[model samples]
Target: MRRTSLHDCPAPAKLNLFLHVNGRRADGYHLLQTVFQMVDHGDLLHFDLRADERIVRTTDVPGVPEQGDLIVRALLLLQAAYARRHGHPPQGIDVAIDKRLPMGGGLGGGSSDAATALMAANALWEAGFSREELMALALPLGADIPFFIFGQTAFAEGVGEALLPVEAPDCWYVVIEPGVAVPTAAIFCSEHLTRDTKPVRITDFSRHTMNRTDSTGFGKNDLQAVAVSLFPPVAQAIDWLSAHGDARMTGSGACVFCAFSSEAEADTVLQQVPGIWRAWKAKALMHHPLNTVLQVSAVIE
Candidate 1:
């Protein structure tokens, strides 16, 4: 009997250590600078190659359209590209996603899933696309998608596509999800959004600036003020988390996190959070878990 080619992959969520909007593009996209740190808490994906040439999702993902599911779209994108280049359709794969990261929590769960699909499909299909090429495809999927393709802690700039790998300290995070969805575009488009903050150099980031070691001192989230003003739940979450430790809003809004020196400390905060609110204690990752998975697979093969 042929050995089953089991491919299990992780879709890690990200925390925006800090986000600053300094400008807006001519095409209406906002210019930004942020540090993206991967976290241990996220959704999981498992893949199995299929004999048929059609991509299928074995797991049901509600509230996401069939055609628009990032995983499905990512598979199709790779399939079409492989067909065009290789003169034949690539073998299809059945994708199973075990969702853990909360949706619309600014955890980059969706983008991470999309990246996992891209990486897994590329491997399963035997496509010879380089990481750079894969990231190019990832960009249109979501602003946060490309970083997962790179799979490392990065100082992101230029609407979050430009990446510079950074070595971040290992730390524990207390993430609190207020159980509400904050519209990202609405926050960005708000009249109250700040768009004229000055930018800082990557090397200039120091502990004294923000008194925070995990964030890039480049800037603050331009959308944060707008998010906090419009969404009282977000503000409440931030205030609640900050009362225990150093708390900051991740991404646009809806999720706020506190940093702790130890897992025990994080657990303490996690316990204090009300049972009605969604909360987790996860470690900050300096690199993406997917990268480690890929590297190990290479060695195994």
Candidate 2:
């Protein structure tokens, strides 16, 4: 059976339970550790396979040009990788993205979009790349890209590449997007950022202590200080949410979140949300939507 298009393929957003900057590597990339928790919410992309070699995106993704768009780049990279493996380029593809999540909100929206492209292209083209191969192709695009490919709640280290699956408590979140675009590079490069926070074992992040706002808990996102100092909206959002529960910035900034044990609790916070920010009640996903589609057992052996 031949398929013409793949639709409603979701590329969900992720929250950094806590991000810590240990030190700068010799290569200048920051070394860090964090837990990545996928949310049931995010962008959706569709693809229509083309017969000829003309890659196109059917819709405009604001702020990203066609050529530089990560989705387009993923398709091109997969084609190039296939050409290297075989003798010719694969068929072209048309991508359509229903943009939902906010960009620069530290939600991994773009990277998730890129991951979706790679997976769809692999299936649409019948390329048969292993999970490991797909992740390799993802890395050159973005650090978080590979994690989406890996597709599970994980404790990540080493610039967010290394991963160990973690059991994040089944919880819901009240995510607030402050409508400010954060510059991740600028925040990481800030002279005022914390770089030497003592590392904690992943086991220490057990469910019982995960909600603590103290120093030893999943207490802080290391970049939050820098992000708050630079983006007032992020700070404002955090403060507003804090009136209900402990809230903190995720990833590098521009969005803040607080966790609740149940959907109703999260929704209560959402109802009380101020008109200034966009708030969502999102559930944490145990795995990526594509987790079962790709067989990775072969790569393990």
Candidate 3:
């Protein structure tokens, strides 16, 4: 059966359960190790095949120009790659984004959206690219894009490209948006940023503590201190949320989160969050909702 469109495709958000900056590459990319845990909250996307072979976005995304949008760039990249491999471009796509995640919040929303576009297009066009092939194609777009395509809770290293599937404990989170976008470049470039945390093995991150209210023993996000120093609102949010648990900023953020063992605990904190910031509770997901769509299996190196 030929499918012309995919509607309500989910592009779930992720929390860096912990991000450690191991060092810096000579090329200026930071070496990092983090556990990426997908959450139920994220943007939704709709894709329609375009007979004209022109990739387009049908809706306006705040602060993102159509051409600059990652969704468009992802489709074009796929289209070009498909043409080179198969002697003809894959049919174009029109994408609509239902944006939920905040930009620059370190939630990997844009990367997730691009990954969803690539996967959904591949399935709709019956493109035979393997999951690994799709992930490879996704890398040059964004480091986080490949992780989204990897489609599982992952322990990642090497500028976040090296991925190994790992278990993230089942838990709930109280995520707060602090109303400011923390630029990733600024956080990474800050002199105050910790660039030399001793690297730890995957086993060092025990899943046993993941569901505990005290996140104290867990590895920390190296970027969080820099983010807090630069963005006062982020610090404020973190301070406010910490009363409930071991609250920490996720990603490079303007958002901070704390884990809870039960939905009720997370919800209680969510209700008490100051009216000045937007907040919600989300459950950890072991795999991407779209994981079943990919029919191929290949180990991630």
Best by lDDT: 3
Error of 2 at 177 (Å): 0.6
- Identify the candidate with maximal TM-score: 3
Task: For candidate 1, write residues 1-301 as lDDT tens digits.
Answer: 4322446688988988778889898999999988888989898899888888978888888888767788898889888989998999987788888999877788888899999889877776778887888889878878899888887878889989998876566778888888888878888888788888788667755433344543323345566678888888888887887788567778887788877767888888888898878898888886667767666331100
Prediction 1 TM-score vs. true: 0.92
What's each prediction's TM-score? 0.92, 0.93, 0.95
Q: How many backbone clashes does candidate 1 have?
A: 2
lDDT per residue (tens digit) for residues 14-56 in model 2: 9888888888888879889998999999998999988898889
Error of 2 at 149 (Å): 0.3
List ranges where model 1 is wrong by over 4 Å: 1-7, 206-219, 296-301
Superposed Cα deviation of residue 159, candidate 3 (Å) = 0.4
Q: Which ten residues in a row have the lowest lDDT in candidate 1?
A: 292-301
**Clashes by residue pair, model 2:** none
Candidate 1 displacement at residue 271 in angstroms: 1.3
Better of 1 and 3 by TM-score: 3
Find the 10 residues in a row with the least total lDDT in model 2: 292-301
